[model samples]
Target: METEELQAALESAGLSQYQSDAYVAVLELGKASAVEIADACSVPQARIYDVLRDLETDGYIETYEQDSLHARANDPGDVLANIRGQAATLAAAAEEIEERWERPPVDDHMVSIVNRFETVLDRARTLVAEAENEVQIALSPAEFEELRPALAAAHDNDAVVKVSIHAADESDLPDDDALSGTVTQMRHRTLPSPFLALVDRTQACFAPQAHSVNQYGVLVDDYSLTYVFHWFFLTSLWEVWDVIVSERSEDPPILYTNIRQCVRDIEPLLADGATIEVSVRGYETGTGVRQNVSGTITEATYAGVSTASGEHIPLAQLAGQVSLHLADGDEDWTIGGWGAFVEDVEATRITVESIQYE
Candidate 1:
């Protein structure tokens, strides 16, 4: 490159403005005093000494003490090499930070675990072993069998392992002997809903099928979506399965309880102008109803009313609904025929009588 171009490139590489000017001044003068260098480079005379010292330290210029001061340019090759080396070091540090930030959030997760059954098993084992209070598994019998060892390990660690199986028969579970005396403590149930597993109300995994030979699933760590999953699992699926396991059959109470809890847990999370999904098994002629309603809230003088295009009203209209069913607790409560509404100082809470999702 030309001399000016080379100097500009060096400056761009990381040279301070004063340093670049001083170095270029030394190159032009061959040798010069601090005052002469500063005058030649248009740098402040008072800062000339420090700038020279910095350039010399950086190996861009050589300085000598005389009557005043004398300096000369270092080899341009060495100066450029030093600048490039500094640039490379900065780039490497930036790349290292980027790599760290891009890494998966899971602790101790290995990239090699992808599509590797054995690695997945190891990951599952590690996750299960880390469970503290509760471990829930929704899996087919075959899938459950594959993770039986890890489940047993969780049980050994004093974790409550609640297993929801999709087996055609409960007898498909390993005989009581396989549980090593912990079978009695294990909460086993059959779920009609599709696959879902939760651990300590934090981590969850779900497959697409209720009963499937393949155990392909995605494991999610503590996240916003996990909160929604926990609500759905505990209120709807788990409650219904609990009833099924307890009563050994799907009863009307189980359906009602699950539906009530589902509505209770899901409503608050809905955005003000968003549609809420209600999944129910029995609605039209006792067949079932699964529907989505776009709801909007309108604040009024005395109260607010939420409206939707469908028969079900929006959550905002909850306060004025004549026949809503309100849950009993330490709060302002009202029940109407269609659903329930609870009014607090901040907002009105509404619960659906029955909900089903399409």
Candidate 2:
């Protein structure tokens, strides 16, 4: 008996369902007529001749004429070799399709338009399912439902998923317990009309339908393009307002997306006149000058040596870089600057460590 996985692979390798069935059936029978092959594979006798013809043309089988038509499976080794060659060619063609069809320039952001809503939905699901590290998405309820099954599969595979729902209230979140086994971090805040999904911070999908009745989308593969879309969504996420679930049970690590959030985390310390000993370890974004500062925070916003005007300082002055440090046994943790914070977040270079607090 062929394993289910092997059968799936056979179908995926470009064999039609009936073709695969006929090939396997003939192999099991050693030699059989079209009628016999059909019976063995449960295919209609009318379809067997065409199935056998395709299999023969594809080098999966041989046909002989006797008193009745007879068919036999090809040598397993030869069949496998042909399949391998076909697979290699198919893979090359797939790559060539992207190259020729996309023709994306390396210098600028490239966007591929997806016309069909179904195609957009499939691509979005694939982005989530194939994520290695994280999937950050701002989803319409429709988009969310469309991708939930794949998201569940990704969850089962240990990929992290964070979803921001375009719902007015937490109660408006998807109540169906389809994802009973998976832990899906859902935050309910009204998002924009267009649905957006960012995967591994590398791939982005913008499926929107506002001005027109037809749903359309853009698939982004370029890093700058991906970041721009993500930043836009994140910026818009907090636009107008954000609703946080109070008394929530889980406390996920704070992933600072912007300067404000980073500053907000340390505001209490600065307000209470507590001098927080912070260590920053990143270079200035503009000059690339290595900045290493270890000292008290005069203001929560600026991660700098001088007590300069944190809000008023120009972006070029600080170069946008900082490292956050916590003392051993110190519950307080602050390690990001606004301009620097945004830069670090974009580059995934934020470093947090412990420093000796006198």
TM per candidate: 0.34, 0.47
lDDT by residue (tens digit), candidate 2, 12-97? 77888888888878877999888889998867988888889988998889998878778998788876876788889999999999
Model 1 lDDT per residue over 220-316, tens place = 6654555566666554555455322322122211222222233333344332333332212212212223322212222222134433222343333
RMSD (Å) per prediction: 17.7, 11.9
Tell me the spans in candidate 2 whose CA falls farther than 4 Å from its real position.
1-109, 153-160, 168-172, 176-185, 189-192, 210-214, 238-260, 271-358
The TM-score of predicted model 2 comes to 0.47
lDDT of 1 at 233: 58
What lDDT would each prediction earn against the true structure?
0.53, 0.61
> For model 2, what is the C-alpha lDDT against the true structure?
0.61
Among these predictions, the greatest lDDT belongs to 2
| lDDT measured at residue 15 in model 2 versus the true structure, 0 to 100 | 86
